[model samples]
Target chain A: MKTITNKKNILYSKKELGQIQLLLPVILVVTVFSLAPLLRGIYLGFTDYRLGDPISFNGIENYKQLFSDEYFWNSFKIGMVWTFVVTAIQVSLGLGLALLLNSKVRFTSFYTILILIPWATPPIIRGILWRQMYEPNTGAVNILLTNLGLISAPINWLSSFEFVIPAVIVAGVWGEISKAAIFLLAGLQTIPNDLYEASKIDGAGLWDQFRHITIPVLKPVLAAIISLTFMWNFNTFGIIWVLTQGGPGGLTRLPMLAAYEEGFKYGYIGYAAAIGNVMVIILSLMLFMYIRVQLRERTES
Target chain B: MKRNIYIVLILLVGTILFFLLTRKNNNHQNIPLRFVSLAWQEGTIATNKSIVNEWNAAHPDIQVEYIQGTWNSAHDYLITAFETGDVPDIFHYESSVIIDYAMRGYLTDLSPYISSEMKNDILDVAWATVTRPNGEVDGIPFLIESLVVLYNKSLFKKEGIIPPTIEYPWTWDDLQSAARKMTKDTNGDGVIDQYGAGLGLRNSANIIMNTSISFGGSFFKKEGNHFVVKVNDEEKKLLQTIVDMLYKDKSVSPASIGETGAGMIPGLFSGRYAMLVGIGSWGRQQLVENAPKEFQWGVMPPIKAKTQTYGASTQTLSIPKKSKRAKEAMMFIDFMLSSKNTARLALNDWMIPARISCLSMPEFKDKIGGWDITCSAVSTLSIGSWLGAPGYVEWKSRVANPVLQELFAGRMSIDDAARRIEHESNIVLSRYKKRGEVW
Candidate 1:
């Protein structure tokens, strides 16, 4: 009777205790691998730490310098343009493709696998491939553009100040849209056919069905992708590094690239950490507000 | 139960055999040392491995393990190894790139390991490359390279231009005119079909900084017994000449400014480029290998302005500070740099050996691939002012490279480039200065 009472306790139960035990390993792994490094990075932000040099606590000295750093501000401004532009394109196009795949169409599964090809490719490889295509002399882009009579002379896409950002954005959108589409497709599958059927019975048309049923059902997945991809895009380094090396000039030098240059190339580990900390604070505040808005809408609905 | 017993018996036997094998193999009490060699080319890799094998066979008591490393990943690997206290016993790298590591006390000072004969045999220019301002000899330079102009023999003949010899190399003015004289539109297209010269300015920072020595343009200068970042019109001379060749004369292509030396090879062989200036000496070896059988090429001696000289960018071998068997590792380095062995390595790598005795090797006298010219230019090599300077790497990559690139590309005016380079370089230097404490 005592064992049964223990299992039946409202505050704590044996079954619930067993579930928590199953999660202990996962919790430990996350704490050790992810949480510890993040916390250490934040702590290092307050110290003057260069590679192979002694570390000392310098309070907000790095941050004070960061405020006046023209390079840092330039990177942040470019990163904003890159992250928001890539996220907006990835989500909107992804939803359209997700809707097309969710309907009862032939070869839906085959097309779903095809949609995952870009996502399956690694970011560095994608950068290299896109770089080759953007090469001036013998690139496929130049060849295609020539055939279409768009321009006479070949333009060096990656080396030009005018065309580099849009060119890199196109490459970023290509590599990331598949991931967004796959997640939204999963959400689309959960929307029952009966919801659309009930909407059609209420004299709803196609856009009406989408506006009333599909939009609300896909909101959660959109919110997740929006905030998550915004963060991921802002922190992107490898692809852009391989693509332009933030160049023609520093036109595409994202904040992550600037931090990497400082930490690895310039050996200012503390300064890099400070940049990362500032980025995290801004991202976290935005994410908090987004989640709160999401929750409020869920309750109102 | 019977199957379980069989498995236990097999496991017991395996454990006993493993211990017996290890115990038997531990008979030789050899002190192991690791040599991290960054030799990537096919010929150089073979030579390096063979040298290590010879060292291992000749000294059974001191076993030196050969760990292959790549040029691309060497910097990151060494930094991590030093920070984690897993330093290799010996390593090979360039002199300038290791200045930071030496300054941070990761390198063992090799002054004690040097023999008078060995010290006297190598050129002072090479030794000066690895010597710090405080006279700490952190490494031993074994090979040296200088800038050379690789030109097409056929085009020089076709244009009736006298190919510059080592005794009378082209002056900067001569090179500019020769470029203009050779540039032509063979196909009658409005676009120039054959560019006269390719500068290979992709690494223009190192090339220009070194070449600037001929014009007496030292990026750093002495003030009150200390070095400060100083850029003026003297420093702008070489870049301005190259820019004029690019934009004013229209003899060199803007593409050459973007392309590396290796990338210019295709243009050189295809008759699209007549001369490639400011390329390393190793480029001649690559040209010999890739050029068509009938296409003849010759390397002009180092070009001149006020004087004929190039930066003594030398490759070095250093031991880690924390190595237990530093003496043994230094012995291996010493043996590897013997006159005969050094000649063999330099011959295969197409680099000039730093040891003066190694220059007399019969292979260097061969006219093929302009060996005679390259060996003759050895006298012109000098120690660069930027050697072992703090924050030099940052300034080179950030200020000098982009400034030259834009100047050659006709994007930025010379004044703006110079002003930005001076302003930005001082900012980079000021961080490494002795403030209240070490930063």
Candidate 2:
């Protein structure tokens, strides 16, 4: 009788049961779609899971192979370099453009709209457009430079091992700067007018004002933007694929492109899963860094 | 609140159950098969769709739905479909990938279904391309195309040079001298105004294989339990000849360093290149459409080194193993590959007919500018299929492509490139060896 009473007590009331029923659909969807794939990907990293073959546990075999794989290491190193260089240039240019736009300039609205054009254009289209523009003999850039008497010969931009990475970086920056500028401009507009007036009254020059006032005020926004830029640039794939395909001796190969080649092109699902897991860990580290910076800023304030 | 929640739960469950109960169930008597094809040429795509629609109109019980696929994404799409078990019943894919699919056990062997009459109707090489080592026909060849040298007639006339012909195709040295003669800088400009030839950096593997075969040297030869990478003196000499043309003579177009192979067509049309080597028969439509009205172009067999052999890229249609409507699919394949239909497709498009009967069809006898030479070259050439190794896709894309690109870009030496390709290709081939797959 006591056990029966306990079972009755454990059962939910009508209202509680209704609440649980309402949330069940969302829980099921997440479990089936999101959680399951994530768990499977993790599990496959520990197993040899070639497509159409029976998966078997291989412990850390995939990861061990990756550690010794030269292509994997080269791609990772290049990925880091590309991510850092592209992000740094994008942020600096964005900040500079924001400052220029924030000034009392002519056609401010027109300039803002023009600045948004690259941001609005799709990345894939931008990659193709830039690839054409970088062509050596007939490209518009070469034509202009030749007319300007800048150089005697057309430079092999896309095919040259030395120039391919920088060429892609320039294209990446051109496509990305507009969004970064817009984001920074939004932050700039939120600065109170009275702060700038007080700084001017204190005889602060432009550089001094920027260093002391703007930088301090924009720190949080800049941190967010930089963190997001790092994440996006680290995972960049489509543009590189369209432009170079990591060619001319794999000079521009990135970790994401390598992962795609391994998984989709080569059908090495286990190896690709291991690479993907490593990327996830790296991204998680970046997120932790972002959080730490935010916490530091909060404490400082 | 409890009553409302109860009402919502009941409604959702009832809706799902209603859908489950009312879902359309296809009948066993009527079989529907899906056929996917690449949008290779506009005319070919239209003709294929028309053929399928006609088949559907006549056959009520067995139907095939046509799905168009783009060249770039079709490989990935097929792989994804196979993974999900949603593959089409009949799909057209490149011959290079058919071996991979066959080895993976994803394709049905059509050996028993192929009638002896049909076997005799198709070209021996075309039939051999689709057959596995175990003597199982996994696919039916749809279109056959071979690479040939196309020269600008006006340019040759202006240079007072007789172009290569089928009876006496230019040897490597003869071709080199012709290129040098054709290359000139009009208006005394410091830069070259006309190039003698344009060779593709990406498709270098195909050209290399063709050249090596012409010189009687097989680059990839099957040895005991593995394939040996042997680049003999003849192959080395061929590579040296190309390097000399590009770097020393500077007669070959520099478009490889500027534009991709596919993107070099406009250059050829604009008279930038006097000769385009290793251009396939499919390039005729593009030339006719894009070239200047007065531009005169003629085709010849591929240049010879020591022999006259040619490699053909034959795209085929296959039936997946998982398909349930295999018989219906086989019927559809037969209808499509019949002599009349094959000739119709070949006439509409510039593709050389794979069927022996279709080669003599009235439609193919008409004088299309490039068809005669291309057809002759494809049918008579005794070279084995190129890039048909077990892991040829990887070897081509990863090893051959990049190594040649590096060599062309002047980043790596020819010896280094060859060595790296052999090493990397062997590594890739090892994957298949571990699985005990026959090349």
Chain B TM-scores per candidate, in order, are: 0.91, 0.92
Candidate 2 per-residue C-alpha lDDT over B1-439 given as tens digits, one digit per residue, 9 for 90 to 100: 6677667767867877887665433334464788998846778888999999999999988888899988788878887877777778899887768877877778889888887777899898887777766688889886786777777888889889898777878898898988988788886868787889887665477667755777787677777766656666777787788888989999888665534555666777788888887766667777887788888988876777877776665778899888777778999999987888888787666778888898776656555567767777764555453344667776777777777777777777778877887788777778767767674
For the predicted complex of model 2, DockQ is: 0.47
Considering summed lDDT, which 10 consecutive residues are worst modelled in model 1 chain A? A17-26
Best by DockQ: 2
lDDT for position B36 in model 1 = 94
lDDT of 1: 0.84
- For residues B1-439, write the lDDT of model 1, one tens digit per residue: 4455456556756876898787564334474788999876678889998998999999998888889999767987887788777678999999887777787778899988998888999999999988876677888888897778889999889989998887677899999998899888888867677888987765588888888899988788755544576667877787788888988999996668566777777788788879988887878767767788899899898888999977878888999887767898899999888888888888878888989898887788789878899988888888887776777777777677766667766789888888888788777777777531110
- DockQ for each numbered candidate: 0.24, 0.47
Which candidate has the top score in lDDT? 1
CAPRI-style grade of the A/B interface in model 2: acceptable
B19 in model 2: Cα distance from truth in Å? 9.1
Off by over 4 Å in 1: A1-12, A146-154, A195-213, A293-301, B1-31, B435-439
